[model samples]
Target chain A: MTAVEERAGAAGADDYEARLQAFTGVELVPQRRGSDPVNVPMIRHWVEAMGETDPVHTDDDAARATGRSGPVAPASMAQAWVMRGYAASVAPAAGHSPFDDLAELLAEGGYTSVVATDSEFTFARELVPGDEVSVSEVLESISPEKRTGLGVGRFVTTVKTYRDAAGEVVATQRWRLLRFRPPGRGPEPRALRPRPAINRDNAFWFDAAREHRLVIQRCAACGTLRHPPGPVCAACGSLEQDTVEAAGRGAVHSFVVNHHPKHPAFDYPLVVAVVELTEGTRLITNLVGIAPEEVAIGLPVVLDWLDADPELSLPVFRPVAGKGT
Target chain B: MTAALRPAPASVAVGDELPELAIPLTRTLIVATAIASRDYQDVHHDPELAVQRGSKDVFMNILTTNGLVERFVRGWAGSAAVVEAIRIRLGAPNYPGDTMVLRGSVGAVDGRRVEVAVRGENSLGVHVTGTVTVRLPGGAA
Candidate 1:
């Protein structure tokens, strides 16, 4: 048999897995030291990108005004940091990450690894500057699937927890993948590992329970206000920054009308739009109240935040109150 | 986390074929995709998770997978391919350095609306197989 198909085949599964088992275990050995405290620029970038109009994530003084030590980035932003540790730990060896290698070895065990069928994250404390987090990763269990990708031998169910230096569980996430074994000798399917990592507003975006506002981080040096926060000022490359409120007035630079309803995150036939604020920066968002046939480039638009999720407000734009179709 | 995805074709049709496009699955491409979408689950990034999970390497998530499909149709058909509905079945995992063929063929031609069946595949297998509906820019033929 060829080398590619050698493993994952009945005869090959036993033979190849023997060599891989002792080698690719991704279970964390010792706790890892994480990167420095939450970078505001990075958090700012994420908040702005999401078009969240919550006060806490965007306003530092506002945050401090509300009893916070300082401006915190976000709670669920752990996603921005978790994989970096996995990537660093896996860098020297096969160049593949612990997560990536797991799928490969499991496939050798006679299964096909599927990407997250579902995911969700629970947050405890907010991540802020000066807060150092260390991650503890654990492989929870192994399972087998019956009817996917020739039937996969699902091997890994993992929990990656991010704790402050104090051991406080800032965020905890459990992950699952559908691993299918070979059709004839498929592993019996058990309770599917339910993924609990759905997307949600980060802590930074939910700083205050009583306010809503759009945040634009301004580079202290050049007065350059940018959204979807970042480290370097796009124009001057200076990292000095602070959050500022915007007038929410702009012209549509471009837009698209989506008809596909894939992720249950939202309904189908939605409007995705890009607008250029007076500052000359462009931001992406969903345009509400406008139908597919009425969108056009250079159209005037205004900001309207979603009111339901107090912690999170979606920035949706619409034709200027009295503007074009 | 991903900026409400980039602008899409303002309009599309029932069976308009967006010319096939190629997206190199580079390391940067893969990682950027995961980060952009805020997908923290391990299998998408941890190689060991990949090994333990039973596959060759980290696989792309449906979010990124769908984003790619969105990007492909938008880039090819421009403001003409308005994706009304995107139904995709995850086929296989795509690793870094792999070449993804973003191919879309016409599905149906109904009045001013159209749909294009699409996929993003590598030699290992097709990673994303789906269909998209868009309203052509200048209305339908």
Candidate 2:
């Protein structure tokens, strides 16, 4: 089929009002396949970057010796792989959706969409590397908005599910999007928010304001640089450390774009990304001037600063221009 | 969902059920999650307009709901199993303070793919309910 037909298939029709009314609780669209798969190494980077010093992802022998099929990735870190095709666009031939696909679908359907508020799962089995999992998701339901706040429309409800490679259901994620009209606007000038930051914090090497440049507070006793600001070093358990900026370039590692914004002041098509710094340290920041589709792991990037506050310069990254999209 | 606590376990029997978890109903919690999820829609944070339509309080967001589901399930499933996929529906108004019970039933097992039925219930009735498809190690089948 043509690419336009493909994106429409992934995102659904522009005339959502009628399609929504005919919604039958579930619509299992064919997945627009991509090459990106969650490898064990990627999972390790994600877990370590999130400050989860768990050995399962880091120590291979320990994981294999544990009687597990293989190194078990953190369950919470599942979000890394489970959300790949969320906003994937059909081939360029698909054409611009009547609305921004999902946004227009919601607006046209009159469904007040919002972030997924709650979810529940039953882990029947564990997954490891070399396992090719087939993810099949379906549009469960769409709850239309029937209220407003600050003179804007508001409503929340959008649920979906994912299946594993074995055709077994691995995760079921229900997303609630609190869609609202602009606080004050004429017709429709609102925008979607970027997805929230992953559980990543409590680091000493960097801050949103200072752009630490990879400074590690030296552990007066043990000589080592800590990217993730910790009270004590893992090796010698030393409390003292030093701040240092290693090389500012690293691979893209992994990243996500937020077409559906979460904050009012935030810009749409928001890019929340994670980068593996030159010192092998990983950091999370906003990706500017690059389209989400253009983003790829292993893609090199450089640190860019933002002067939100004269005293506090926020550190963000931009795709090394000319290197790629 | 009764706001009672039970021994939290990773593995439950075919009929075993999960104790309901209740997060207090507050406009702030809704807004904090809204901000975190990058979902800036105001209806969740504004109650007056929420009341204007049909909800009791500003409704909770899908992002927060998804986050809560991720948190609740991980807490129950022992942070080990890989979450492959989940599909659910938001039934009644999940008001703050209302404890929510995530009910599950091991329906059928095929190798590692365990067919199960699960739902989220509160004092108001079934708030969010659906079936779950999971992959387990050994299957009774």
Which has the greatest TM-score? 2
Candidate 2: regions farther than 4 A off:
A1-325, B1-13, B18-38, B45-55, B63-79, B137-141
Error of 2 at B67 (Å): 4.6
Residue A81 lDDT, candidate 1, scale 0-100 = 53
TM-score of model number 2, chain B: 0.69
- Give per-residue CA lDDT, model 2, range B1-141, as digits (tens): 111121224454666554555555465566665443434444566677656544567766654444455444433443233344454556666666666666566665455554455576777877676655544333222
TM-score for chain A of every candidate model? 0.42, 0.42
lDDT measured at residue B86 in model 2 versus the true structure, 0 to 100: 53
Prediction RMSDs, each to the true structure: 32.7, 28.6
Q: Model 1 over residues B16-121: C-alpha lDDT tens digits?
A: 5667777677765666566655555566677787666565667666556655665565555443233444456666677877988888977776764566788778
Tens-place lDDT digits, model 2, residues A1-325: 3323433433443344456544434444343222345477666555433323445554666555444655775544344454333243223324543224555655653344333434544344455665444443444555554444333443333344445655666544444445554333333422323333323334333353354454534456777655556678877897666656565677788888887736764666777888887776677777766877888888888876544322334467877772433
Model 1: CA > 4 A from native: A1-29, A85-104, A110-114, A149-155, A179-325, B1-33, B36-141
lDDT of 1 by residue, A93-159 (tens): 3344455566567665556534554333455655777777777666666553334553534545667
